[model samples]
Target: MDFKNEKQGAFMVVVPAGRMDAVTAPEFEQECERLIQSGELKMVADMSALEYISSAGLRSILATAKKLKGQQGEIRFCGLEGMVEEVFSISGFSSMFPVFDTRDDAIKD
Candidate 1:
């Protein structure tokens, strides 16, 4: 996966692209760790460019969410499309966190 980060006011908008399987999931987690450590706790995950995901990706997301919760931080998701969106919905992630149609919508709330 590829992570593109941008600063938008008080939040960091992260655009994750490509497949997020076992091999790339750790990279995703690592990136989130770096951002969190840098004090960018409020993050917006823009997944529109992402093509695929696996169970390992879900695990990575869970781990990140847990870590953020401990730090009183939060991660919101936006731009979900295709199979990635379906997986998140089926996996109950849609209800677990905030989901928005765009980065602006996420940051607005």
Candidate 2:
């Protein structure tokens, strides 16, 4: 998996592409940690280019969410599709976090 991060208003928009599996999950988590450590609390995960995600990926996301929440921060997800969307739904992540159909919608609020 690859990540592209950018600041959008009050949120840090993280765009992840490719597959997020066991090997890449740790990297993803680390990147989020770095952002948080840098005082970036609000985050938006734009998964439009993500092709796949495994259970490990979900775990990483959950861990990041919990960490941010502990700091009174927030994380939202957007642009999920295909198997990625199915995985989130099946894993109950779709309800756990705020999900938007577009990056604009995710950042609007």
Candidate 3:
């Protein structure tokens, strides 16, 4: 996966492109860690360009979400479609994290 970073007001957005599967999940995790370490805990993961995801990808996101929660921070995801949305729903994660249809919605949350 490729990640493009953007800053909008107080939020940091990470726009990821490509498949966020087992092979690329670590990169996502690393980016999250970097954000957290930098004290930019409010994160918006713009997944509009993402085409695929695996269990490992979900796990990585969950871990990052939990970590941010502990810091009293928030994380939101946006622009999921196709199998990516299915995986989140089937895993019961759709209700666990805040997801939005657009990056603007996610950032607003």
Which candidate comes out best when scored by lDDT? Answer: 2
lDDT of 3 by residue, 1-109 (tens): 7889999877899987899889899999999999999999999888778899888999899999999999999898888888888988899888998889888777774
lDDT of 1 by residue, 1-109 (tens): 7888998878898888999999999999999999999999898889998999999999999999999999999999999998999999999999999999988899985
Among all windows of 10 consecutive residues in model 1, the one with the lowest summed lDDT is 7-16
Off by over 4 Å in 3: none
By lDDT, the better pick of 1 and 2 is 2
- The CA lDDT at 108 in model 2 is 85
Task: Give the Cα-based TM-score of candidate 2 against the true structure.
Answer: 0.97
Off by over 4 Å in 1: none
Model 2 residue 16 distance off true place after TM-score fit, in angstroms: 1.1
Ranking by TM-score: 2, 1, 3
Question: Candidate 2, residue 46: CA error in Å?
Answer: 0.4
**What global local distance difference test value does model 3 have?**
0.88
